[model samples]
Target: MLIHRIFQVVTVIDCVVGMMASGFIVSVGSTDWMRRRKLPACDRILICLCSSRLLLQGTILHATLFPELTQWNVVRGHSVLLVLASTACLWFAACLSVFYCLKIATFTQPCFLLMKLRISAMVPQLLLGSALISLVSSLPFLWVDYSSHLCNSTRSHLKNISFESPTGNNISYFKGFVMYVTWAVVPLLFFIASSTLLIASLWKHIKQMRQNATGFKDSKTEAHITAIKSLISFLMLYICSFIAEILLGIPSCQAMSRWKHNICSLLIAVCPSVHSILLVLLNVRLKLAVKSILLYMKCHRKQDSAEALWQERKSMSSS
Candidate 1:
């Protein structure tokens, strides 16, 4: 019981931090859009990614963390919606990875150059296409009978029992496989491929610079390195989250202690928020915005403290 409580507290903290980081991305991007009356392609993608993640995290919190507040019927009915939102979040993150690879990685191939030239114009369309694909892929879950079963299984071990009908069981397993492939495997492949190409491009650039005796210390090189590091870190976190999601589906894991289950849920929930923070750190504009906000808050706090101290001193003198 104590462990469960501790995990609950940890999950709440993770959710709050993750939501705040994603919210920051949305606010910053929206502000930029308002100022320019049009956002850059990257900022537009960031806004979509952040908004999806924010909604995903909120839904996860309500569905997993505060299950009592949500009736079983509501949870069952909205399970498809939750999956759709999460799918959108994952797809958008993958889209962002692809966007970065296209924008930052240099290639000598004509196709690559053409893509680089056209990527900015293509981003909005790409995002729309991704959303449409995610929706279409997720629509099957709505028709699949096993969604309610999965939802109930998450809440209790009773629903994890085998179905009497082998045909139903087979169909459920098939649907599960399809969902895993579409939601996890597809995005992972895209992320891995993009990361590999980006790394190779950066490596080649570094080697050429070294041959030219330019060294590898320029701002551009540093930016490339930072991007590579961020991508690698996000990939690692993504893999962990993917594994956690898989494990959570297993009956044995669901039968475990509540704390153990909560731990897996926490792992899955934190990925988007943590990745957004990494994005902010890697992007100069976003980082500056976060820093400015922090500095303003610090100054405001100091001013409030100073005013309180002055009032105390004045009251003492009058007394």
Candidate 2:
């Protein structure tokens, strides 16, 4: 148990660092790059997603540090809303990937169809999808209380976690299974399948375009590939998380086991960090923004040193 607590502490620290990095990336990357590009506003959407993810990470981190909140107690109603918001962000990101893939692949038929749909129409759909999933996933929590030791909606508690019926008035098992299917299994499948197909389609298109010596603009193709790689990285992170979740759910698996906990804890942090890397490494506008931020930092440091020197001279004169 002491070892488990230590692991949780480490995981929390990592999550905090990742969240901070993501915040910086979003502030610097979104306004500087996404807004400038006049692209379909995907990067800003991702920034919002990452921010929600960061909030989820913080909730988990607080739970790990305090430990007394238990599974059912840790995530409040608003936390559930944030989690649902995160899911919405992720779905929007998947849509962003699909839009990007179509944009790059020059699938004129589908592109025309997609263009006919307004961004406003799409936002409500994604939000509704997220809301339904959250509602279903959280149904089990309504039966349990803050004191229950069982893994309610959030999968944190193990020993004191209530699995059996509390008052025999509730269907805990049924609800738990629903939560898993709605939140984990189904969403995981969609994330994996959609991202995989998008990548494959982009790959084929890029190869065909290359072979045909098609008049497809080279710079545009390269930009599409960059976005593709970033999306692939995001999807792969989700896949890792899905696998970790499955491993954690196995009956034979020890809930407090180091490996299960470690992987699960790490995913909480790693997912957002991957987004930060993509923004800085893949997007040219983000890279420039980072460069500008660095330059500003250097200049600020130099000014601080100059101020210190002036203060020292003034002190010497007073002496």
* lDDT of candidates 1 onward, in order: 0.75, 0.59
Reference-based TM-score, model 2: 0.74
**Could you give me the TM-score of model 1 versus the true structure?**
0.85
Which pairs of residues have clashing backbones in candidate 1?
Answer: none
Model 2 residue runs over 4 Å out of place are: 1-6, 25-40, 75-90, 108-121, 124-136, 144-169, 212-217, 250-258, 317-319
lDDT tens digits by residue: candidate 1, 1-319: 6877777777778878899999998998898889889988888888998888787788777765665543334643455666666777777768878888998998778988888899899988889987887777666654444533443334653343532222242345346545756565787788888988999999998897888875347888888999899888888887888777666655343434465578788897878778888888888998899789899999999999999999999999999
Model 1 misses residue 89 by how many Å? 1.9
Error of 1 at 17 (Å): 0.7
The candidate that wins on lDDT is: 1
Task: Give the alpha carbon lDDT tens digit for every residue of 67-103 in model 2.
Answer: 5543333434433543454454455455555545444
